[model samples]
Target: MPLMSDGDEKVDGFFRLGTSSGRFNMFDRFASLGVKWTGAVNGRPEDEFGLAVVTASTSPDYRRSSAAQRTESVAEITYRAPLSPWLTVQPNLQYVHNPGADPTIRDAWVVGLRFAIGSRLID
Candidate 1:
């Protein structure tokens, strides 16, 4: 996926004008595009399971802020496998990036896992 934006403007004192006729106004615009692929293998060397991959990107532009432009990207991977006849486990990992900011909450890597148990209750 791909995205693009282009515009021309002129500002005189407090008034602004666009290239055509409309007045230039301060606004924030954002655009995002992504792609994903998923498939399952009946029998393979790695594992007889499913696999998926997703990638996304975002671009944000602000005309009236100290931070004018910003970009971010993220990727996630998940794997599921049968532990036993009545148990299953899934693990996930993610990568993220944020440009222009302190290392507080936006720039980091995350990992997680999930487990499921299936059984019939006996009375």
Candidate 2:
């Protein structure tokens, strides 16, 4: 549940324990945690802004196969601004660490943009 929120604004999270590897998977017997926040931005309650962080660990299988890297992490920050009632534009930034549980592979930084449209149906 969202423990932090002011009406429309909310924060939520999750915890997971499982496997990520079997036939060439990255993490085996893996564990992960993630959090997400959804709220308004720039005094635009009708618009949207969000931030999320997620992290994971490599399982013993991965460790046995590759010991150099054992953890993975990613963070995403994004904002959406409304250009019309049904149209909006969003921009995003993301950083990743220990991608694919391979220390030899460099961590990554990414940026992107998205466009969205919403519709309401009446019957």
Candidate 3:
């Protein structure tokens, strides 16, 4: 929720955890933690900085049947900046370790860009 707030500036954190029965799900356990800061960059309230890590465990049944590794994890860093009131762009960098939980596969670095657009129907 709201971790800290100073006038129009703020910081927030989040966590997520999940589990499955291991019957039909590919992953039996999953977790993620993240934090975001607003208005911390050059006094731009619309700009945001974020960091997060996520991990998942392959279900026992699925690992046994598919010969998959036990776990996969990723760490990511990102920044979101607004181009206008209704449009924003986010650039992110990620390091994926044990992707798909396959030992034969190599860990990799990934870069991505995302664009978000929003508008008010009526105001």
Candidate 4:
């Protein structure tokens, strides 16, 4: 549930936890927490901005064989804007620490884009 809102502008926060059942999985535990803000941009209510942090722990069973680091963490920032009623574009940036949970690999900065398309079934 959203914690606060004023018209189309709002702030929301969330947390998630997950676990894998099998021993063969690369990750045994996952957790994330984040907050997002949505509001009018150029008088359009569809624009949104978000920031988040995430972490994952390597499974003990998998780590024993690979000698991998215990955990990986990431910090992310993103924005979403509408290109049209049915299309939207999102640009994202992330800093990954301990990429793949391997200390030998350098931390990395990643940039990416996402596109979303949707339509109503009955107009």
What is each predicted model's overall lDDT from 0 to 1?
0.41, 0.71, 0.91, 0.88
Q: Which candidate is the best by lDDT?
A: 3
The local lDDT score (0 to 100) that residue 117 gets in candidate 1 is 81
lDDT of 4 by residue, 1-123 (tens): 587899888888999999995397888999999988888465867788999999999998878888788999999999999888788899999999999998799999999999988694235
Lowest lDDT block of 10, candidate 3: 114-123
How many clashing residue pairs appear in each of the predictions shown? Answer: 0, 0, 0, 0
- TM-score (C-alpha) between model 2 and the true structure: 0.68
What lDDT, from 0 to 1, does candidate 1 have? 0.41
For model 1, the run of ten residues with the poorest summed lDDT: 8-17
Candidates ranked by lDDT:
3, 4, 2, 1
Best by TM-score: 3
Instruction: Give lDDT tens digits, candidate 2, residues 1-33.
Output: 555778766766777667556447655555555
lDDT of 3 by residue, 1-123 (tens): 789999768899999999999999888999999999998876688899999999999999998898788999999999999987778899999999999888889999999999988784234
Ranking by TM-score: 3, 4, 2, 1
Query: Candidate 1 or 2, higher TM-score?
Result: 2
RMSD of each: 16.1, 3.5, 1.8, 2.1
Measured on C-alpha atoms, candidate 2 has an lDDT of 0.71
